[model samples]
Target: MKAPYIFNIQKFSVHDGPGIRTTIFFKGCPIRCLWCHNPESQKYNQEVMLTSEGEEEIVGQHYTIEQIVKKVQSDQIFYDQSGGGVTFSGGEVMTQPIDYIVELASRIKRLGISLMIDTCGVAPVENYQKILPYADGFLYDLKFINSQDHFKYVGKDNSLVKDNLKFISDNGGAIYLRLILLKGINDSMDTMEKTVEWLKENNIKISEIDLLPYHDFGRDKYNRLGRKCTQNFEVPDEQHVLNIKYYLQQEGYNVKIGG
Candidate 1:
């Protein structure tokens, strides 16, 4: 397989996963979440961004598996010392060519580096199965449990996402749940309760649940790309975020404020 389209290669990202890591931000996503921070990565094709300096800059670039491996290998020392490795993030990493992803993952595994796929869990179960062997684990995003709320907020149903999560869990795949806390959007008591209930019902055992507070940091990117920011959700305060964390903890789940 050839190189896939990538919007960015972020190095020394402490939030993506364990230790210090290099995050490959793949271009394109299936769902249009209201609170997406990297809007530039949503489109599959290359796009031009108008910079503040009146210059047109391309948003996506392609890199072969070998090229990406080389870039990731550069951080070998850090990974060896810190237990960190390569993380394939998005737009939605699964949105890329599955063949290319599997090839890339295989190469990463061959290098003996930890591999983590940060996904929204919107892809098919087969896609997850293909790469599961190469991946050390998954950073699965759980937006909304209710189908109607999920579609209204993320423009997609939750059935596939739920099914994928269950499949991974049942197969003994390591999962770390990531939930974006949007104020008055997906932060209600009902949502939290349902999320806990769903996890329990599916018998999914996750290492940790990361509660990511919603932020408008991507608003500027939307403007630079000449795209409309349709969602105006507010970020949850520290107390509210802690409260939800506490709730999850009370339910016997290990929860953290941020990833």
Candidate 2:
């Protein structure tokens, strides 16, 4: 009878995984990445935001597992048709109690719906292992392979991220490594090369490397919250993104932008 605290649920989402999905955005995160697109999700507690309709709305709503499953199962026909399923996203879904994720995912899988998790991999190794079985695919975020650099930009070390990725790879699961290419940050040639080398060395064979060019999509959210905009947020140009794509391609890796 456990109910999770969820911030939002987006239906007909295509970018999260292999098919059209209903993405459940959970309400918490452990790290404070400066370039966060979903600032509302960063806080472990609920926060209110003003909608364009000029109404105040809280970020999270409590939902029982049965209730959410009912909503998701309503789209079972679409899930079957589009090869889509339920995707548990977040500030970081694993940040929630592991039992909740496991229970929800187990139910989703039982109904033959593909389950996915979009995570930054900052949680404990045991946490990652807990949900790995129920997920059909994972959009794994690899912000910075270099631990120090990771802590500086992402406000946490990269050890857990790396370790969880290695564990996922070892378990023969479907994992997509997402790299956010921020200008003057981790977008340098050395960082990219080193990251590529590190992944290969760890025996992690990602089917595709999604090079996400940094942008200021979250700036307005910060403004809405009356918070200061993150200074020096850099979005790389087309040439820069293309160059990184080519570099990874040359390394025999399939590369795409903004996956």
Candidate 3:
């Protein structure tokens, strides 16, 4: 496979996974999440955008697997010291070049560097199967239990997501569930109840659950990219977020507030 366009290489990211880690943010996503903070990650090709300060910027760069491995290799010491490694985030890492992802994962494992795929969970099951052995865990995002809501907000069918999640869990891959909470859309108690029911029904094994509340942090980026900044989603209140977390905790889940 040829080189792939990656949007960002964020170093020392603590929230993506365990410990301080380097995060590989690839360009291009399968879903168009309304509250996505990284608007630059939505497109596959390189493009120019105006920054907040009105500065012109070009996003996306082609990177070879060897160059990326070398970059992450520099952080090996940090990974060893802090239980931190590399997180392959996106755009949607799973939907990117599978050959690149598989090869990079193999190299990362060969180097003994821990690997995690922060995914939106909308890719083929075979993609998950390819990296199952190399990945330490997955940061799997579950946006909505309702198919309509998922398609309306996220712009795709979620059956594939659910199927892939179950596939990963059943295949013995560690799953760190990420729940995106949009007030009045998917942050209701009914949704939570059904979520618990779904998890129980499928027997999904989750190492942890991250409750990600809605935020308009990337609203301005839309304007910079010459796109609409639609504020269709509202941020879940503090107590509401806590309530969801509390309810999930009651359901015997290892739940946390953020990813």
- Which candidate leads the pack in lDDT? 3
Better of 2 and 3 by lDDT: 3
Tens digit of lDDT per residue, candidate 2, span 1-259?
Answer: 5555788898998888867889999988999888888888888777878776667777788888888999999988988998899999998998898887899899999999999889999888887788888888789999987899889988889988988899988987788889988888788889988998898888997877888888777677776766776645778889988998999999988888887
- Model 3 lDDT, full chain set: 0.90
State each model's C-alpha RMSD to the native: 1.1, 1.6, 1.1
C-alpha TM-scores of all predictions: 0.97, 0.94, 0.97
Which 10 consecutive positions of candidate 3 have the poorest summed lDDT?
227-236
lDDT, candidates in the order shown: 0.89, 0.85, 0.90
Candidates in descending lDDT order? 3, 1, 2
Quote the lDDT for 218 in model 2.
63
Clashing pairs in 1: none
Cα TM-score of candidate 2: 0.94
